[model samples]
Target: MEVAYRIHLTAILSVTCFLLKQGLPFRGNDESSNSLNKGNFLELLDWYSLRNEEVWKTVNQNAPGNNQLTSPKIQKELANACAMEITRVIVDDIGDNYFSLMVDEARDASIKQQMRVVL
Candidate 1:
């Protein structure tokens, strides 16, 4: 509930998402309950927090709550936010650049035509 704690949690969540996008494997759903104790990201964060005492006072103090960023709903929200952020960045980058898009039409086993776009 402290401002500092909120900021700390945000930073941790951001870093976790960044690593996740980079193809790193985080503990799956089954391990979410024990993430703080056994998860790699939290383990490393805990190790680093020891030296940076001012940034985070304690591991358990600002740790991710049960339904905070780890819950299924919250995870979907974060994924959507991340996707939108990526789309914005890509659109901005393409504004001044020339890019080619390809569209393909194919028939599926159900005899339905499907269109796919690649950029």
Candidate 2:
């Protein structure tokens, strides 16, 4: 992959991980379509741009006309890949080892059922 593409992908993965750690949705209602939304990946990119102009510059350099990689569909696909890679690493670390896991189920304030697994 091109360096700019790699950098962009890395930035996307980093932001996705941050969102996952915070238990926040990567895409909001306003971002359901192709348009950019403030609280989602677009905001993350803007944050990066502000935090470090050089890094954002590198990503923008290789980005075609626009940053198509920042689209919601692309972001979701990249997030899934990131999750899979993380799970694979965790599973590999547990290979040939016995580990105890606890699953807790509860309803959140919105009355949605949620399950958390602790290992």
Candidate 3:
């Protein structure tokens, strides 16, 4: 059971990272099971499971409802965790070194003003 849980988590995390890397939105307008497109994250997971038996069993069938780790909150937490790890790596690589920071203001697809920071 423990191994199965780990596999399930790994599969979800892989999909989450892929979406994050692509700068894609995680949720769709309708995410019901019967919906044609159940959002990028869920749709990706389903697509992945079709090619991996262990992931398919662990995620789609065997995982407990409470611990499926597919909630919106879980997705946010996973992305946050990935971001923190990336920041840690960057910081470690620049340890004891001076680095220049750049900031820029921009608008996203929704025309929302945002700040971009680079280290």
**What does candidate 3's lDDT look like per residue over 1-119, in tens digits?**
98998899899999999999988899888988899998999999999999999999999899988998888899899999999999999999999999999999999999999888888
Q: Write model 1 residue lDDT over 38-76, tens digit each, in one string.
A: 454545455556667654553445555552344445545
**Candidate 1's C-alpha lDDT?**
0.61
Looking at model 1, report the run of 10 residues with the lowest lDDT sum.
67-76
Give the Cα error of residue 97 in candidate 1, in Å.
5.6
Question: How many residue pairs clash (N, CA or C atoms closer than 3 angstroms) in each of the candidate models, in the order given?
Answer: 0, 0, 0
RMSD of 2: 3.3
How would you encode candidate 2's per-residue C-alpha lDDT over 31-90 as one tens digit per residue?
543556756666776688678766577655546756657777877887788789988999
Whole-model lDDT, candidate 2?
A: 0.75
Sequence-dependent TM-score of model 2: 0.73
Model 3: residues with Cα > 4 Å off, grouped in runs: 105-117
Least lDDT summed over 10 consecutive residues: which range in candidate 2? 31-40
lDDT of 2 at 56: 72
Model number with the top TM-score: 3
The runs of at least 3 residues in candidate 1 whose Cα sits more than 4 Å from the true structure, single-residue gaps closed, are: 29-37, 62-68, 96-98, 101-119
> To one decimal, what is the Cα RMSD in angstroms of model 3 from the true structure?
2.5
